[model samples]
Target: MRGIIDLNSDELPKIQDKNGALKRPPAGKAAVENLKIDAAILRQSLVAQAGAEIIIYKDPTEAVSTGVLGDVVMMSKQSYFETFEAAPFALVADGGEVTVTPLPINRAAIHVDATGGLQTASGIYGLRFEFSRATLKSYPSIEDAIMHAVVQGLARTGDAVLTAGIMAATPAAFSLAAAAAAGVRMSELRGLVGTAGHGAAIDNNGVLRAAGIAAELSPDLSATIVGSFARSAVMIRSDVEVVVDRTNIDGSLAVTAWAGLQALLPDTTRFWTVAA
Candidate 1:
């Protein structure tokens, strides 16, 4: 008895092996990991860039307490307290009269009104390659585009917050001519801060442009970005979130970050104008 041969076995049938059916390839794990690393690096770079532009006060002398208040956040400020003088007591030489001088009372009180609300600075970015012609060509993947957008947004947010804080402080002004050195703008900034009784200084491109006392006097003060934090400094707390959607062929990504800017001593902060 001859066994029957199935011709259909050799022929490519419409329905192949049920167990070996063709399916879409799963997304690669390496690709996802690479994207994550790139995104983190970009985020960090942006943060540093923003930090350089603005003065963030994180003085070790002061203390910052963080807490939540309803939908808002609160940061309590405790000023640095110190007393250098000692009691009036002097060593007396044998048979010699010792002079006694009254001790001076020096007290640096924490400003009761120093308490401030943590101001929220947020940046949001969306990456939709289908809708973005520029991104589609420039970025190798949607993740790359999303990362760049997120970084840019975060940097901008930081810059804006710092700028506003400096403006509000409104320290005194110095002259560009009075600048200690030609290339060193920070020196001039230091002078202004010293005059305003602040110990710290911030000099950036924005400050350079704002250079001028006349500009500072204007109702819309627009002097160099130089300013002083006075006895206390500006503090910041930040949080970041990122999301990616791979449900469709044309996927999307989104990133958001929030930074809270609070002054250690709201009343102590001062801004200055740098004049030519």
Candidate 2:
């Protein structure tokens, strides 16, 4: 005859103090003797299941200028990450639908490209999607798997666009105003005649339009800067003369300018000459 040992409340004191001062265990037997206590399960079994994620938001600011005086337009964006699942796994899932709302762009709004299969905004910078799970494939159905991938792709794509957009606006230092007269003081060379720079002036005629360029700096000075006029008609300040006889005797060229002046030009020209 097979018999099982029972460890009931009688054997494993379920009640508290005689006066019931101590709390009582669940009003049930302790455990079944036939059932073994699995130490491996206590060690390996995931106590909880959770999916943690992080997201970032980037927004580029626009530039507004009036001639030579203008703000160094840059893409300004709100950048931050949202993490899901902290304590109880329910926190992340509690929010039914995760909506990614793109910032409004009256001109060319940033949109998602599903066919692109998760590319970074501007196609540069580091934007990636990470999934963590006890067992990778836990989705109940194929549709669910695709849906998850889509969501992650959208999230990563949005982050890439925003991050790249904002980074694209990071302020840059200016270089030598090429058209400035050779002997002119770098300080006096305020507005540049280059395609870039805050006060950098360019009066390219209908060429930009003809080339399909919008013919204007982006709101944040972050859009494509047209070099159409760079080759043909780009002329520097009248005082600045192009020198055919000039040659770098030192076999090197370095720029020296104030921070303010640097801010007005391209970053490639921020370096200055060490006082020889």
Candidate 3:
């Protein structure tokens, strides 16, 4: 028979036997109960997930210009990892067969055993944009005001990126009438375009006069908006929090995107800069 212990003794009850050793419980019952306190502390030790959003807008005028200026290729991250190769030279001959040996000296060096064989060379250039980052912050304010500022800021940033990229890629695409001058004469711009074999029409203020190309030489300055989105992982949470016993509301938005200048032909696309 098992010995029974008194519950009202001065000593606390023990789960062990007389030897002060622990006694095993029944099968699977030997595990201790998990203590889950339902009580909430009065301190502000709680953290709520942040709620922030981001939006992007492109300029309408620039959006329409893409068609005539160039081609804008939307590239995935995987595609961006790949390298761009250009074939600048090819050999052709009138003979039935020809042997060609490429000299290691320079790109222009090519040895051909057959006469009347012609080696034509063209330029091939690779282009890619470096990664960039932008951020916008808003403090506690009217919801409408905060939204307005954010939208405007996003549009301005996008426009600037697109403009800079285009200008960098094709510096000669548009000739500046004068440095540090606004409102250039239409006639001067026309003459410059004509000399370049581009039939671009310009307004009095040197703006592209049309959204479509009037001639083969003219590039349309119109553009279209491409993909734009907020980076959720980098966006800050929009929420009210107490810091140093003061209540404050703050939020931020982060974005990553690619702005491309559209062109009819990728091979013909030139990403160069000319001195002002």
Candidate 4:
């Protein structure tokens, strides 16, 4: 076996620049052992994505009482006490009807503790919730074309054909066989949901079919499938932005990694602005 005993370390430069400016290089053992950041590299570190700007404070009691802060806020604000069925998610609208606001001291003769009051007035607050990995690209203006290929290729060869067909459809559809298969093999995925959440399926095909109710899949559950597979499949909410994480600032909301990417078409679809 070839060994590293005689390799020359002097030829290796501290950093290398490709197309951009000379930037900070990754830290090495020497710098890490010394508990030091290479100042030379720190100065040129590149930012990945812009951070959100909303900040929100929740009632600790409510946060602990309910499994979700977003749901608690919705129930308290909307005046509903029913248990949530679907997983909780939130959206920080841009100062509109559903704008974020501080909790009032009193509501319907009920007094809210000052400590747990909404921080909208005192400061900014943002909403947060969990998102499926399949929907991660829903917000960004990128095509799943590349990701679709990578994910499909990594799966069975038939998955590549299924993915291509789905992507081509107006509202993509996955056959029952495909959906069941994806759900089963979901454990083996690396580049998509499985990798992001560690064996989490994120229910990509199932969720997408559920969301495509009015389009790709017939809303009438009785609709028959004449495609490659038999049996109609269930649908998930595609356009629904599951609030994963958020911070609110003075009424403005900063959302965290909301899952799912909106469709790439731009020809006046109803789900366009809503998803955007």
lDDT winner: 1
lDDT of 2 at 115: 28
Worst 10 residues of 4 by lDDT: 47-56
**What would the per-residue lDDT of candidate 4 be over residues 151-267, giving only the tens digit for each residue?**
222122222222222234433233334435433232211121111122222254544222222112222122211121211111111111223222333333323311111111111
Off by over 4 Å in 1: 1-138, 175-222, 228-238, 243-270
Q: How close is candidate 2 to the true structure, as a TM-score?
A: 0.17
**Compared with the true structure, what per-residue lDDT tens digits does model 2 show for residues 193-215?**
21233332334554222122223
In lDDT terms, how accurate is model 1? Answer: 0.35
Task: Please identify model 4 stretches exceeding 4 Å from their true place.
Answer: 1-12, 16-23, 26-179, 182-184, 190-276
Evaluate all candidate structures by whole-model CA lDDT and list the values in order.
0.35, 0.24, 0.23, 0.23
Once model 4 is optimally superposed onto the true structure by TM-score, how far is the C-alpha of residue 90 displaced, in angstroms?
Answer: 50
Q: Tell me the number of clashing residue pairs for each predicted model.
A: 11, 15, 17, 42
What is candidate 4's TM-score against the reference?
0.13
